[model samples]
Target: MVNNRSLVIIALLAVLAWLASTSLYVVNETQRAIKLRFGEVVETDIAPGLHAKWPLINTVHTFDARVQTLENGQSRFLTAGRNALIVDSFLKWRVVDPNRFYQATRGSTDRAEALISPRVEQSLRNAFGSRDVNTIISEDRDDMLADSMASLDTAMRDEIGVEILDIRLKRVELPEQVTQAVYQRMSTERHAEARQYRAQGQEQSERIRAHADRQREIALANARKEADRLRGEGDGEAANIYANAYKQEPEFARFYRSMQAYRKSFEGNNDILVIGPKSDFFRYLEHPAGGASK
Candidate 1:
């Protein structure tokens, strides 16, 4: 009788422990929980805490409520010019309505992402639809995506219960053929510009050099003319001096001229003169007087 009473008390305590274990649950600070009654959502978003539920009648589904990132790589879209672009981008989002999120994705993160990715891609496509590669590269990309971003955020909030906090573009690229063509065109344009610059430089340099050469020629001619004038004036003054000396003393002038001639005639030892003894050239040698020895 004592052993039966002890066994009954132990069994009752064990059942109570099992019930408590099943009925009580905990939700972390970074998580959100949903209470479902027989797989039908009864309580929407249960805040983070220890919560109680009817054992075996209600269950809890918890999800990470923190912000999440969806990496979108290599999504192809068309431009206004009908050219193709490969876009690499990412999205920042979080679940705002856990009930709707659970309903739409059935608590599957993968399913939520699959639904969100196509919409993001479509919004990006809409933004890119009016722009070509040239316009995209050369213009403000923010203006292009502003309307689409807002619209996508609204749509994601409504449909997937996810809030789009941000969208970012990592890279936008063209096909190999298009890239090569663009490079070739740019090279040709650069070459043409360089040729034009060189041509202008050469023309200006030639003009400057020609102007310098002309100025040099003018300066040399002026110098030569001045030199000639000065030389002619010197010779004329010397002739006038000689005339004045001769007018002052005719006999002295003749004697001085005769001496100068004799000095030059015997200036070099190798000099020789052969003349008649009675030549008028020897009149000075024959006599010292101006009239010679008669």
Candidate 2:
């Protein structure tokens, strides 16, 4: 009888331990729990620490109340110009209403991804598709992001039960063909600009050289003209001096002129003189010292 009582007591203790283990739950600081009995939510627990529940009949579903990140796959889209592009995006979200999250999504973060990813992709396409290629790639990117954020927030609130903390695009890229074409166009533009700068430089250099040449020619011509004018004036002044000298003494002038002519005519080595007695060359030549003027 004592052995049977001891065996019964051990069985009871094991059953109590099992029940106690099933009924108790510890909620972490980052988690919120919902108690569901028979597929209907019976209570929602927001505070952290230990809690009690009926064993086997009640189920506690825990949700991460902390912020979460969801990164989207690469999505292909087109701009207004019919150029195709790829966009990579991500979202920051948190569980605001655990009851709503549990009811609509059963606290399955994966299910939330399934619902949010499509909406994010759709929002990206809708915002980017209406924009031109320049706007998509340029300073208007911020506006595009804002539009995407607004649209995504609205879509998430209506379609899913989570709040989106933020939405961002990781990358935007042109399609392969479009990228190649843009690169080609950019190269051509740079080449054209370089050629234009070179041509302009050549034109400027030619103008400078031509202007210098023209200035040099003008200066040389002016110097030649001034030199010729000064030479003519010098000759006129010399002639006037000679006339004054001749007017003062005719005989002396004739004698001086004869001496100058002799000096000029006898300058070289070879000499030939053909003159009669009456010629001007013989005026200074006397036949002999006594018979010269007789």
Candidate 3:
């Protein structure tokens, strides 16, 4: 009998433990929760820490209140100039009103993203449609994103209980065919410029070569003129010396002249002279003083 009583007490304790578990719930700082009765939401925004409810009658659902991200999506958009671009992007969002969020998404992150994505995409499309590729990619990019959120943020807040924080574009590029066409045009322009530069360089080089040739001709002409002047001066000085020698000693000059004539007249082995020996050409040979015969 005592064993049966002890078994009953243990079974009661087990039942109490089960009741304790179902009666209490917790909501931490990073969580947002809703209490439901019979699968219908009865309360929302439950405070953090432990709270009590009727066992097996009340249930709670919790969601992360922290910011969420939707990433790695690509969309095609057109520019004001009708240029097409493939944009890779991501979005930041979070639930702001738990009651309204529960109504809208039924506490499903997937559903929330599904509803938010198209609106964000449409906003970006509008923003991109108003601007050119240069403006969208350059200094006005942030402003364009801000403008995109003008209506999107309002719609998300009012209907979906979500806040659209930011939209970041990872990459923007042209389609493959457009890219190829642009590359070909740029290459043609570069080759033409290179040809122009080469022609200009050759022209300048030819001008420099012609100028150098002209200077060389002038230098050679000046050298030849100076050399001729010096040669004429040397010949004139030699003639003056010869004349002075004759002036100083006329007979000595006559004797020297006769010796020179004799050496030239017999320089060859075969010789014949038809002139008279009494001619003035033999004065030196005849008198040894180059004087006229006595």
Candidate 4:
């Protein structure tokens, strides 16, 4: 009787331990959980802490409630101009509604990704299709991404219980078969731009040189005019002085003139004159006293 009682007590303790183990669960701040009863969802978004449920009847599912990233590999898209481009992209998302997320993706992250990726690809394709190559590659790229993120978030939140945080293009490139042709076209465009800049520089240089030449000509003309005015003033002053001297003494003026002529004629000792002896040049030499025939 004592042995049977001890065995019965051990079995009861084991059953209680099993019930406790199955009923109690812990949830952390970084995790989100859902409870199911007989494969039917009963509770979603369970708060973090110790919780109790019906032993052996309730099931709990936990998921990481953190932001996640998905890197979708390169995909080819067509621009408005019908040019093909390879776009490498990534996505950021997080589960906001656990119940809806569970229903839409059946708690399979891979399935969620599979559904989200097609939408992203389709969005990108549409965006690229409506824009030219240059616009798609450079100008409207950020705008397109912003628009895509908004559209994707709306669509996903409405259908998948997942919120799209962002979508970004890692890289954009041309197809291998068209890379050389595209490169050549880009090179040609750059060369043309360089030529245009050079032409503009040359045109500006020519304008500057022409202006400088015009300024130089004007400066030279002004200098010549000033020089001619100064020369005229000097000549007039000299004539006035000569007239005043002649008025003071007429005979002295004439004798001074004759002396100047003789000095000029015999400025050098090697000078020779072949004139008549009674020439007016000899009048002063003949008189040499008071005066000569003026």
Report the number of the highest-TM-score candidate.
4
TM-scores for every predicted model: 0.79, 0.71, 0.69, 0.81
lDDT of 4 at 77: 93
- When summed lDDT is taken over every stretch of 10 residues in candidate 3, the lowest stretch is 135-144
Cα lDDT of model 1 by residue, 88-117, tens digit = 999888888888889899888889899988
Ranking by lDDT: 4, 1, 3, 2
Off by over 4 Å in 3: 1-4, 37-43, 140-144, 149-151, 207-294
Q: After superposition, how far is residue 254 of candidate 1 from its true place, in Å?
A: 6.6
Model 2, which residues run further than 4 Å from truth? 1-9, 219-294
Candidate 1 accuracy as TM-score? 0.79
TM-score of 3: 0.69
lDDT per residue for candidate 3 within 41-119, as digits (tens), equals 8988888899888877788888888999998488988999999998988988888888889989989999999999988
Error in Å for residue 288 of model 1: 7.6
Candidate 1: how many backbone clashes? Answer: 0
For each candidate in the order shown, give its overall lDDT on alpha carbons. Answer: 0.88, 0.82, 0.88, 0.89
Report lDDT (Cα) of residue 152, candidate 3: 83
Clashing pairs in 2: none
**Cα lDDT tens digits for candidate 2, 1-294:** 999999999999999999889989889999878888988988875578998989878989999888889999688898888888888878898776677788778889999888888887877788888888888777556566786787677667666557888877788888777798989999999999999999999999999999999999999999999999999999999999999999998667877787788788888789876767666554655532222243
Candidate 1: regions farther than 4 A off: 1-10, 225-294
